[model samples]
Target chain A: MRFGNKDLARYPFLREALSYVTKNEFKIEDLDNSEFYHLVEKAKRKIEDYVFEGKLAYQIDYNKTHEIIVQEEVIIFLISLLLIKSISIDSVTKKFALFESMRFERYLISDLDNSNQDDKTVKLILYKIFEDLFQTKVDLEVDIFNFYKIKISDYLDHPIAFQEREWNLVNRTVDKGYVYLDGSEIVRLFRNELYLLIIDRIKKMNPEVLPDMIISISDSLKSRWEKMYPPLRAPGHQDILPPCIQHIYNQIDKGENLSHPARVLLGTFLIYTNKSMEEMIDLFKRLPDYNEQITRYQLEHLAGKRGNTKQYFVPSCEKIKLNNLCFETVVCKGISNPTQLIYRKSSK
Target chain B: MTSPTTSSHTSSSSDKLKDSITDSFNYPHSVEDDPNKIWLEKVFRKHYFNSSSEIELDNYVSEHEFGFRLFDGYIRRHLNFKNKRELIASIIKFSPSDIFCSPARYQHPSASMDQKGWIGADLIFDIDGKDLQLDCARIHNMTFCKNCKLIEKEVHTSCSKCNSSMVQIVELPCQNCIRNLKKEVTKLVEVLHDDFGIENNSINIFFSGNNGFHIHVVDESFFNLSSMKRSSLTQYLLGRGYLVDNLGFRIDKSDNITMLPNKIYYNKGWRARLLSRLHLQLKNHRIDDKFMRKITQIKETNKIGISGVINNQIQNISVKIDPNVTIDIHRIFRLAGTINSKSGLVKSRVNNLTTFDPFKESCIREDALVKLDAFVDTKLFFNGTSYKIKTGINNIPEFVAVYIISKGIGDIYIEKLK
Candidate 1:
């Protein structure tokens, strides 16, 4: 690990502590001070208490709290991305890991913003804070810990209720209020390549397995999202999609029913852009055959284009509108799902 | 320890020193003679701890268990962050064994470096009065570090005076390390550029303000890349390799092929490339007045697909909204960052929310939701050690709404269902 100017000046105590540990693993008795020894002792005691409490109840090996702590640490660690600048898309997934932890921090801190600002304002703040941090425009005042509280709540109370497979995520978050992931765990959580592979595998599976396969796939995707952005309560009155889906939503037309596939598409887009709307739109347009006729039609449709009832060869062309402006809509009928359609939109 | 009764109430009190900084008696006090914990805890409690009411006692106890890890990049050379080495040399006089530790998050992948970045150190520090007790409890239950990371090894150098261990390291390179590790940094930058079709001008580097360097490529082209492509860039830079298999458009010998089993496709590669082009076009294409013409043209092209080719260009099914559809102008503007929320609806909401009602602001609904309600309702998750938005009985939404609402594109209202 490297030391920055700030870390060098403010944390000499940390450096000294690190020096002793990596060298010879010392015992509590090795150090001369009792206060420092007591601190460690206390932590071990509480952990033991949790373990004992669980054991007495015939629960799992370690208290779920231990894993929650580990998870919380990872979340804070992810926030360190703020210390670094020039954040790129590759770093975006890792960035979400920080946001995930911040959600947990909020729960720990207790007090969060209680403004009447639109739900989007809250959503925007979450997104903006990350943007500010990545761009080095951080508000030293913006506490990442409190931020996680609202986020975790949002996940738990996600507007779309949890299903059977989401039980693990629900248990981890609802029961412990934290989700654990190490460096590898974080990587695995955000590794979109794996999801793509799973989708590919499902494509090869026989039709009989398709339903279960899709359910399993949705479960895995949801689980990953819960780990990445676990919530404590479902989405509240704010009609805006969760940060996970806002940018990915083709359009936020009123009464648009959100399907799992649509959410996944939105999630994938959000993950790719670090949840930046501008970045997401950019990624959407860059798919291999994204500019082909079929792709254009879909993109136009998402942009709010409506179909031209009079068109013969094209049957009915779609029309989309931005602001008050009305534009022709391009449609892709073959792909029933938004996620696959997004893929089709890009695959020429 | 001296008993509180024996000491001059003001003699060695840290609270007295802090009092001079703030006249208000808002500082948090503990049972200890040493007021450092009290003061730090006071500041932390005010800024971070008070952000939520829903937090369970167990949760609060846990946050205190683990003192947040600090990676502010403010350490001096001739120190290590591994255990208590850095602490003893610079700040605290303690051993690493005294504190419980965990791995840091968002660590730069070694792919960003030529060599494995130096092994770092971790420590517990008191910010806003956090101490061994609260920090220890936090460590016991909380998994996340509000502010913590592994110290880069190369960032710090050995002390000339004592030859003591120094360990704040740089991931990309320190000025000193750069002289030694320029080749690696350059290699990474080149790889990032080549793979993403990004240009050299798009690449920029910055010091992490600590022991590492951050590399950014700002090309819009890269933005058009999908998650898989972006992941590949990360993997490539981190040397993680590529996705051997995934459902996407693969360019085979300059031809496009869609491997999505049940879908029909004409020119797959071309479509993928077009998608990239449109993505760039949208990113650069603003919604300002000047860009409106092009926007209209796009809409037209999208309408009655100009050719069988254009018809095939659009990929996803088109979703249409009612031409009369109107969203809350305030909400939309808030998201867009164009409208100043101060003068409009928020002002009245603020007034109504706060109990100080001398202004008699009428815009605030007695039942209107205020910022504090919003925080408690939605943004409670990120409220850590700082940035607290409190909601008490006095300030209601109707009070503040009088100060802020203005006619915008439209006002988007999210009702709080009691």
Candidate 2:
């Protein structure tokens, strides 16, 4: 059941790379000696050509990195390194290795700036494919939670629960609306050490051949690989709203009578964004039987403009659910409140 | 209470008080002459100056405001030093009644006025014994009404004599008060370690000489937390101004029944705490006799009814912390190993909090003897020994004398036995 020659049949690229590296005795005396580096460079060149050639039949103008192909190469490279015993995994190292791999998978699908719906869909599909192809055999998902001694149900249902554990394991920044899972610093350094050794030998052999952009790109990719999960904002800015907020917005647009919490959430969200009073009044007019005076008073009250002068915070995720208005989508996972979503959206 | 003293004794006592005040106003000549000064010098040299030979002052004490409370009761504030040796030398020279360092980090800790650019500070929690709600029998505690100039024998929020709200509460630390303080300390440690995920080594716990405990979290990650973030954390611990309605619990309007969601059990923070407590009450017979009987009669079948019972007890479970201390980053804390002017004992660190008896452990002046002129009949306990005093000069251990004098019940004079 182990991942070895048997699994290599399904993954031919891994088999070929393993044979080539093993035949060379896996001695990385120079960059040219490393077939893995050549494969990465080739993959990078292919992505760059695909982006520059205008071959993609998409309307998005940004340069599209063929992340799935890059991910497949990365997986194969890592598997070959594992096979050759280049990247050793002890009990402690195994936990971080799994965490890093999961992070990589998560990062690949993470919507980069300017990514459209089609790009996201492709990245998700590729991430799933990569997960099925390698992550399962490695048992990364189970091992990550097991390392923390937390049940998967507890971790998913309450992501903040991880914050109660060790800081080296998980970092929860509720205000930032994200939880960062830390990979082992030792494993990360080891990977970078090996990568730098290859790059160093490459420069020593041919100093003028390496393009400046290529070197910079390689350095950026290396740093990205080292950081398990850096802070990131949601893509598409405010245009991409959480499903619940979008649902409420649509309801208000159609003059539907929203529930009390929904109205409060909408009003608070608008006020938080510094919407004008007139604009808020106009928006509230969408509600059925919405009297201008009552709406103005309520808005003014929530904004702390009324007599009591108490500014109200937006309803949390649980509040939305308690008010029977929660209609969550997959992206809403690990977010606790509507304000967090707005914060993330605005951070973009 | 004895009969009021004669006018002759009162006038003589007043004249003596004036002479003693005038004499105390003169600063000590040298460390050799004063026992308190000698003790401070020896402790500072042994613990701080000698032991910290290799450590640079910039590492721990840099950019921190140094304050000294001299024996004359005048506080020299906003003082700074260039090096640890200089700071230690100044502390030994002054032999201050109390030493304090600002909790806040600053660019120039010594700079006065507009020059001291403020930075961030360590997240600190101060659990004072005076603030704890201890239901113990009152002793020789006293309070003064500022508005009516009436003194009371017991601590009160308002003056009973004049019905004025401007009454000051003077707290005398007792066994019950210290025990209550320990409970708060334990709760704070749990919240910090279990709830906030701060490591044991990262947290530093200290006994504030007279009446409280101070917790300092030196973890670098929290160094940059804004005041707003700290306020949030304080509110979270105090369980005040929290939105408990957002916990996804709903009530059925028709039957007036409450339902607990299955997901709430897995939710973290206060919601998870609520669920677990409820589950414990149901599993064990820890509920009230009436509720236990009702649950037993129902055979644990009605979760809605049980949840309703648990919901009423939510506020009682949350830990109480001093919100102001946590929120104010610029607040100063008593320097460790320095004598508290009130208690005349060093504010020392507790290595193991569970077995720490503050009264015995903080008793530093055990060898010295002191004569205290008691003004009221009071019973005092120290180090498992009890002393009953009746309005006269009583010779006792220096520690007990300091305890009595700190409570404002008596005046103490150190007497060297030849």
Candidate 3:
């Protein structure tokens, strides 16, 4: 999905790329004679550099590349790749300059009293850039203990970030080097890394000068992006969960002791839906013998905090049947797991 | 079923019996021998081709992968035939020492083709004498250390003399072991019928001739169970990884008592089992008087005091089964009519498993009397008779002779009696 009006206003380069790709209409249009010749010459030079001098021989200016190309689809295609990090800037300074040129520095430094620290300021700007580009809203909390390594709390001053929040929200005692982000937030960060690979591939391609070729390439890349990040459901979509998961939710709601497999299935489902560890522990408190410490430990373990830190996926339909916990409804017929069912129902 | 006719006054009757037993043993000599081939051919012809009904035979071989173990310990596997008669003919020709068949069905069982995918597998449970905990006579077994060449009489994982970890334990099942195996078989049958909803007709129980029992479920629904599903079933049967709290008991905060939902008693599998066990425990007056009074007073409400004693009682009831055999779909079980190589007794299928005694029902040649040359002093029980013999030659029934020889404690000798 394309960025909204607010994101466009915040990042002018994206708006400029969008205008260039659509010819001011956000739709493909016939390239002007002069613009077409310029694109052809640029494509020819890129092909020669790639073929003879290798990858380092050619590099596109992230800020000024729109001037060289006039095809609306090609411009949009490249910008989308850049947004996804499929393309990279030559250096960290150049990357910071590109972001600064997009007017990201004003909003980033507006909240901070001291924005002179280059690394921290750049990280904050990058985090905001990712949030705006992906339209993902992250709840920035000042957590004392680190739940996951890379977090906004790690970059922000602890005293300033924790100023008005409750003492419970800020892990005041533990002095872990890194700050905590929700496990699901960490997943979102990793997803951004994947998007960067896609962008890098697009950045390396010698642009096809033909409008038809560029249009088809743009359409294919858009399809790939859609497939890579399927739209996540809103919290309200929990009502549409598969019958087996709904049954588990009902059991947990009633404070009933769940079987090991049942607990695992519920934990996996909640984790996939981006529920925080505390929220999961709260849900588990309904269990008859719920010990808060033990519940938190188990939830953290499922969240990939313990041992090898490998996150587990929900068990397949076959595994559910094996556990004798399959409570299949008509809707579950063609699906293999609860996650698939969730995605299917929510997409519909 | 054949009973030997011998004249009471004949002097050489023992010699004739000995020679007849020896001849029967020599018939299915090896997979390549002509005598074995001819004998197997006759057997297949009689049982398969000339049988009165073909429906039973057709149903038996339709979805099975057959393998034949030669006398030399090499197994000829992945053999499939079009019809029951053809399969029987092939078995007869080969005259394998042990006939084994897979419980799993493949698209092209005998062909190495890409379309060869597993359709499903039969739900098979095996209860072997080797795994049974018996308190009867101890049969001599050997344990050898691979690392240090140390030998021990009893089975052990590590060598005592050299402290080597590479020790292998070999088990020899005696009559007592078979008796214990029968007990496990009974438990399995009860659990299958009561808990699993399997009908009596759908269950096929067979004695493995040497030590164990194989229970095969022929129900159409059970054929397609995945290995993971089968593994879960094994776990349930073995009582290994069950959460006891999931039986639906919750502590009622109002009265500070553990309350059981009424629906649990009405439920079918483990819930019902737990309810019945609770009833038995209370009725038997096993608990202390104070706890008994508490339970009795709250019997109508289905709530009782939460105590450690009650929790332990709930964990005590579960079926014991051999988990590995049930989970493995490709495991080859011995064919019913084939002779067990170790015991020299036929792997017989019993019509009425509950009343079938292994000693009498599993005997291949009941009437043949043989002489056993014992290497050690041993007391043996077989076919309603118990014999205690010092290290010497003793005349016994063929079944007892085979049992002794199978245990590696004695050798059988056949000669013409003067």
Candidate 4:
């Protein structure tokens, strides 16, 4: 958890760091400058302030919102790292120059604002702040938040990255053309097909064994899926869906030879996509020791179309009419790959 | 089809997985006696009762390597036991109720060499002998007498070392490992009770016999769950706030399998479980569709397929995991908007020709980065079942815009200039 500017002000150095990030103008060159002096003084004062206050922010009013924002500080830390990556000596000097212009104290602090804050006095103060307030950069680098992070490479292969990037380029915006499908259309197109598929799989079964059989099939699908896309090739990048897939992938990876039925269940959902409940049932039926009736009940119940209260069931057919679906073009036509499908179509 | 018994016998034969003989044999006396005596008795009893004669088997003690070969002893013992039928019967009557006959070790061709191979110790007792070692000794033949005890390859040479012997064994860990594991288990139990909803009736926690604890949600509600629901539950268990990850588990060898109430993301730690749950809710229903519409997205990018003529914005879009797979609809539309706008020009210019002007761009791409709003839509499903089929569109949240703006997409400037 972390606190924002409102909370950081209770500690002087953190407050200074926050202020410097927001207000200071850094030059690409020259460490000794007036603004640099102020930066040093401010940072030093914050540190001294923290030392005296003894890190006492506990008594201060803390609400749920503040707590959440504080917890998300790692995200801010990443941004800071990115900023630091681009900072050169010249940029440091420029920032110091901006600081000196603000009539800051000189030389009691070590000037991290860079050599541009070469006013010997400002450098002293800045140095003091770095020494006292912040932990060593080396230590920070190894911190769990920074070092133990899962690199994108651990989850994605080159081909998947290339493909995802290409798709990203292909679908650039919401204006060119795409479509959305309504509930009724989806019902007409997928309802019956899904229903029949589910029924067919469970039509003939030793009633007692049917449920377990269906569950097992689900697990097989999931396990097969994880095998297909291991965590090293996690499907999506920082994407919502991708992370979800990654979670499932990790589970299968850990418990590959699991004997439990639950393990099988996990494997099924992770990999089984683009198929309706009925289709999944049909897929399950092809395996050994499967019952048909239980699958019928489960699939029907799963899609919320089993009991007949004008249920918007899955459509039974494959061919989709152009008029029944909705689309909105996100990218301009003729700009990139013409054959790529980059639109999201929603059906009930 | 053959009867089940025949099939079972075939199953056993196919795998060649023997029901090891160590289970049946018992030492003549307590294991504390001369360790050598205990070892001999255990091996002798297995072969004598294997329905094989004991007279053909032989037994002897040797100082050169401190070992015994079961195969030679098997034939002598088998013949001897068969000849002394009355004595064998009397011994059996006196034996403990648990004792039974076991298979004899078969002799192999090169039993004279001390080379490490399957010595097949029919029964194994205590292994605490001074310089004691048990191995799969290669059996050569029943003809070798006690003085000419079969010697395999000498112990630990460049050519061979004693390989694994098929025998019953027990193992215990070091003190340090036990202490550390106990502490971890205690901490984990507390975490489970506090967070996982694993109270008395619905759940049970168990040791995975290695590292980590397993919480079994025995709630009948979860029994016989389909793949989808189970996945959802798994996600919820591992998600953040559940702290499924922090349930410390020691990674070392142990017998008690620790049951993890929920799956951990990394070695141990929680990611955002609630977010995943929210995502599920969204995916199940189209409720987040409105939120998705609020965030500006590109138009359909499906140029190859037939598409609807409506000019509506993107919502409830699905992205495929396969990167090579073409964008279905929303991705395409988002691309089109980007390609045709000023943001596109900025993006292209940054990557290609002259330095791009961020000032003029006004962070247009940033607008697209806003976290897309999302919600689960119950109205979309015809049936009212709500266990979890979370489906919905996610709008880029507002906070994400700054970062997205900083990171420009490809070909943005070119489209803008055009």
By DockQ, who's the top model here?
Answer: 2
CA displacement after TM-score superposition, residue A205 of candidate 4 (Å): 20
| Span of ten consecutive residues with least summed lDDT in model 3 chain B | B1-10
Clashes in predicted model 3: 8
Query: Which pairs of residues have clashing backbones in candidate 2?
Result: none
Supply candidate 2's per-residue lDDT for A288. 40
Report the candidate with higher DockQ, 2 versus 4. 2
Candidate 2 structure quality by residue, lDDT tens digits, A1-348: 223232232233333424634564543333343435554454444322222221221111123243333334433443323321221212112222222333333333332223443443433333333244323111122232211122211222331232222221122211111222222321232233333332232223433343343455555543442352222222233565767777876665433456567788888877877889997775665454356788899999999999679898877888888666788987787899766766776687
Task: Give one clash count per candidate, in the order shown.
Answer: 221, 0, 8, 225
Residue lDDT tens for model 1, B1-418? 0001111223442322211212112222332553322322332233222222311121111111111111111111111133232222322221110111111111221111222132221110010111111222222221211123222211224433344454222112112332322333454454344323345655554221212222334444332333222322232233221121111223232232323332212111222233343432322212233333443354456544222322243322111111111110000001000111222111111111113221232111233343322212111111011122232222324323212121111122334589
RMSD (Å) per prediction: 33.3, 16.9, 22.7, 37.6
Report the C-alpha displacement of residue B361, candidate 3, in angstroms: 0.9
Measured with C-alpha atoms, the lDDT of residue B151 in candidate 4 is 22
- Fnat of all models, as shown: 0.00, 0.00, 0.00, 0.00
- The ten-residue window of minimal lDDT in model 2 chain A covers A168-177
How much of the true contact map at the interface does candidate 3 reproduce, as a fraction?
Answer: 0.00
Interface RMSD, in order shown: 17.0, 10.8, 22.3, 17.7
Poorly placed runs, candidate 4 (over 4 Å):
A1-348, B1-200, B208-214, B225-271, B274-418
True contacts kept of 4: 0.00
